[model samples]
Target: MPEKFVVVGAGPVGSLAALYAAVRGYHVELYELRPDLRDPATTPLNFTKSINLAISERGVNSLRQTGLTTLVKDVVSSTTPMKGRMLHLRKQGKYVREAQLYDARGKNLLALDRTSLNKTLLDALESMPNVKLFFHHKVVGVDFNKKLAWFERRTPSDPSSRGTEIEISFDFMIGADGAHSAVRYHLMKFTPVAYQQEYIDKLWCQFHVAPSPKDGKYRLPPNYLHIWPQDEAMFIALPNQDQTFTSTLFLTRQGFSDLDAHPDRLVAYFQDKFPAVVPDLIPADELVKQYNENPHLPLITIKCTPYHFSSSGVIVGDAAHAMVPFYGQGMNAGLEDVRVLFDFLDQYPTDRAKALDQYSKVRTPDAHTINDLALRNYREMASDVKSPLYLLRKKIEETLDVYFPGLGFATQYSRVTFSNMPYSEVQRRAAWQARVLNCAVGGLGVGVLGAMWVWGRGGGWARVKRGVLLGCCWIARGVVGVVRGWE
Candidate 1:
């Protein structure tokens, strides 16, 4: 008989894990605390408002590994391509827009609704004969030694009422539950799990920008993720399949509280900070209504060590590392976890415990690296995007990448989003690249200064000019040689 694999949380990561296990001939049972999201009446978990997600190469690659080519094609067809970020701001008393491409190579991120993605994955899983999905079942406890789990099954008709508990025996358990994962809570009981969770001061609320009434088309450009960046706050919108935009406003908790106290000032605040989003995109009354109706939820970052408990259980996705959404990699990283985990499983098919142990040892660093990057990106999105120094650095990096492709030059954003390289490696490479760029620029500056001093000392113009030219050549050669050495 095949090993019995039980997966907790039927979200995208869990569903994909189940699919992977089922495809490998494991009898899989997937459990979820909420009702099936495929039903229109099912309410989503409250941790996050349904902000549209960006599907980058990491996520796309994970799905492709599942061998669900048709599903991948369908997902790609349903998503809108976001080629860049469009900044909306006021310049010289007039509202203006600036576009910043995400990659110099013209790669793009696909905008997708999380619900739609989850439904697609669940649908694929449902078709598998060995896969079974159990909804409205919450994981109450786990026993890694006995390879068993207990779940409290609530009545679908009356979820508030008490319900019976069910005990399940499994050869292994995979947890992809969200930030407040019950499986994670129980896993801590079985091992010396080092866990850290932080709630950022920022809170996010969802808003909508309906399609234009005149033509029923998108009011903003549909090919870009729109951003309004203030120093301490930001508003962003992602295009949806329906021609509408799923927008979010991120602010500090105190800022949210202040807005809640004076709801009337909300419109004025938008007009001042995000002038382009007011009556032009979302009507005043409609914006206020959406703000009042939607919840302002906090962002949490979670990091835990030893994601596995011997051979019997492991955690993936948010259960292992829940990051802030600023990098747009929260889901992508989670999906990638499934792929990486199974790669280990495939390597040690005979000894599942060793595969899981190796996976934890390797995946923990990458997970933590991305989590830190995501947190740092919040500052970049909120303010640094508009900084002249930041843009200049970005331009210099892209120029180097274009001119010196052999040097393995790439921007941090390109490396993180456009490639499936390990997150820790990406971070290390980006840091080294930054140092090289700075040194090269400094060398060039010194060369120019020396040439100017020679000219001031009455060195002939011809000699001075030659000196400057030689300095340029020397710096260029030095940069090339250094980068090649690293490679």
Candidate 2:
């Protein structure tokens, strides 16, 4: 007999957990506070900038491991492949452009609607015999001691009629209900788990660039993720399947306050600073209205210990480690968590408690590590993305990568976005690699000066330049060849 499971939340993470457990023959019941989102009437994430999320190797490979790759791919399509970030800077009456590639080989991540991904997973879940969905039902409480869940009735419309509570039972429960998870709250009754929730003062407002008027194609490069780096404030855009782009503006607390105070001046701000993008996309009036009415939502980060209760329940996804979306790892990491947990469960089928314990033990470090890296990456995206020296460094890194092959380390962003290397190990390797780069730059600088000094006599500068180039070429060609030959 398969284990009977209760999965909380119908969002992407919960849906994936239920999908996998059911496929493994577990009788799974999924609960969601929202309406059956399948109906268009649910009006998914309406006109928001949190439109699409970046999906890369970690997310895709995990889904493939479960054999659901084709189902998901059918509903989602990728962008043209942005070699790097396209920074839009205001200058005079126009915006200047700059580019920075994410990968040394120029590969990039893909962006697809978050709702589209969720709906596709839900569609797959609905088709399964072992999966059952309970929508528009809010989970009010959890009784792990009795393995029971308490719910309040709700309707698709006006869900919070605040009805009497009801109860259901399951053999085991999985919580993917996100940061304010009721399950995590309830579990604290039985065992003490340290928790911290930090509201990052930086708030974000989402906007969109409708498909181009000319045949509804992209106005900008559909393949590249666009950025507007304005020092302390920045905005970014990612492509969508419908030939549109979802843009988000991130500002500090005071920034939002000032926007709210002088809502009418939004047009002037856009006209003065974001001229290249404003006229092409949102009407100045509509943009100001959005700023006035839409949420100036602050990002939240949550960290906790003991993601699971002894034998009956466990927390996964944002429920365990809620992070800001800056690194674009929130959803991907959640999906990866589900995959890793299920693999462990299968590995120790009979010893389920052991599996839950191991899940927490193995995942906690990765969760915390990635959360920190994700927070730090905001500076890179908002400021470093537009720096010339940074782009030059990236080009140098790419040149080395082409010659060195896989004997390399990933940029912090690449480590999280392009691969699923162990989070802690990735951090360690990246630190060492940065040191190597610093040393290389220093050595090259000194060598150049020495060559220049020698050149002052006659043609020393020319000889030195040649020598440096030759040395770099020799090192690259020799190391790459030897490395390739070994492989």
Candidate 3:
């Protein structure tokens, strides 16, 4: 008989995991705390999640590896391709927009609705004969030694009223539950898992920018993620397939509280900070209505070690590492986790225990790295995007990447979004690139200064300019040689 694989939390990660297991001929049972999302009457369990998300190479690659040829294509068809970020700001008392491409190579990220993506994965899983989905079932407890799990079936009519608990036996269990995961809570009892969770001071609220009434098309540019950076607070929007945009306002808790206290000042605040949004893209009245209606949710970051307990159970997605959404990699990383875990399983098909052990050992650091990067990206999105120095560095990096492709030049964003490289390795390589760029700039500056001093003694203005150009070229060659050596 094939091994019975039980998966808790039928979110995208769990659903994908179940699909992978079913493909491997395992009898899979996927459990979820919420009802099937495909039903129109089912209330969404946002759990502080954004309505839309960015799907990058990491996530796309994971779906492709499932052996479902049409899955990736189908999912991508429903998404809008955002090539870069579009900054909305005021200059010289007039609102203006600036475009910042994510990659020099014209790579793009798919802007997709969270529900649509989840439904696609769930639909794919439902078609598998070996996979059974148990919705409205919450994981209550687990016994790793005995390979057993307990779940409470929640009634839709009265969610507070719980029905009978059911006990199920399985050969292995996978936990892809969200931040407040019951499976992770139970796993802690079996093993000494070191866990850390942090709630950032920032809170986010959703807003909708409807399509234009005149033409029934997008009010803002639909090819880029729109961002209005206001230092301590930022507003962002991602295009949807229906010519509308799902926007979010991120601010500190105190800022949210202050705004909540003064409801009338909200529109005026938007007019001052994000002038282009108010009265044009989203009218003041509609903006205030959406703000008053949507919930202001806090951001949470979670990091845990030893995602698996012996050979019986393992956790993926937010259960393993819940990160802030600023990096746009939360879902991608979670989906990538399924691929990585299954790759290990394929490697050690005979010894499941060893495969899981090796997975936990290798994945923990990468998970932590992305978590930290997501946290750091909050500052980048909120303020750094507007900084002249930041833009200069980005331009220089992109120029180098375009000119010297053989040196393995790439921006951190490109590496994270356009490639499936390990998160830890990406960070390390990005740091190395930063050091090389700094060294190159410092060398060029010193060379120029020395040339100026030499030219001051006897050389004329024309000679000084010629010498400066020669010095720049020499330093550029030196930097390229050094980078090649490192490579």
Q: What is the C-alpha lDDT of each candidate?
A: 0.90, 0.78, 0.89
**Candidate 2 RMSD to the correct structure:** 4.1
- Which candidate number has the best TM-score? 1
lDDT of 2 by residue, 287-352 (tens): 877777777787899999888887899999989999998888898899899999998889898887
| Residue pairs with backbone overlap in model 3 | none
Better of 1 and 2 by TM-score: 1
Off by over 4 Å in 2: 45-51, 78-83, 90-94, 446-487
In lDDT terms, which candidate is top?
1
TM-score per prediction, in order, is: 0.96, 0.89, 0.95
Between candidates 2 and 3, name the one with more favorable TM-score: 3
After superposition of all CA atoms, the RMSD between model 3 and the true structure is 2.3
- What TM-score should be assigned to candidate 2? 0.89
Ranking by TM-score: 1, 3, 2
Candidate 1 vs 3: which has more TM-score = 1
lDDT of 3: 0.89
Per-residue alpha-carbon lDDT of candidate 1 for residues 1-487, written as tens digits (9 for 90 to 100):
9999999999888999998999899999999988888887777664246667899999999999998779789778889999999999888999899999999889999999888888899999999999999998988889989988898999998877778999999999999888898888888899999999999999999998999999999999999999999978999999998999999999999999999999989999999999778899999999899999988988999999999988999999999999999999999999999999999999999998899999999999999999999999989998998899999998988887898787778889999999999999999888778767776777687778878988989998887887777678767865775657544
Error in Å for residue 263 of model 3: 1.3
lDDT of 3 by residue, 1-487 (tens): 9999999988788888998898899999999888888888877767325647899999999999999999999999999999999999888888889999999989999998888888999998889898888988878889999998888888888767888899999999999988998989999999999999999999999988899999999998899999999989999999999999888999999999999999989999998988688888899889988899889988899999999888899999999999999999999999999999999999999998899999999999999999999999988987999899999998987887899887767889889999999999999888878777776777678668867886878877777777677667756865775557544
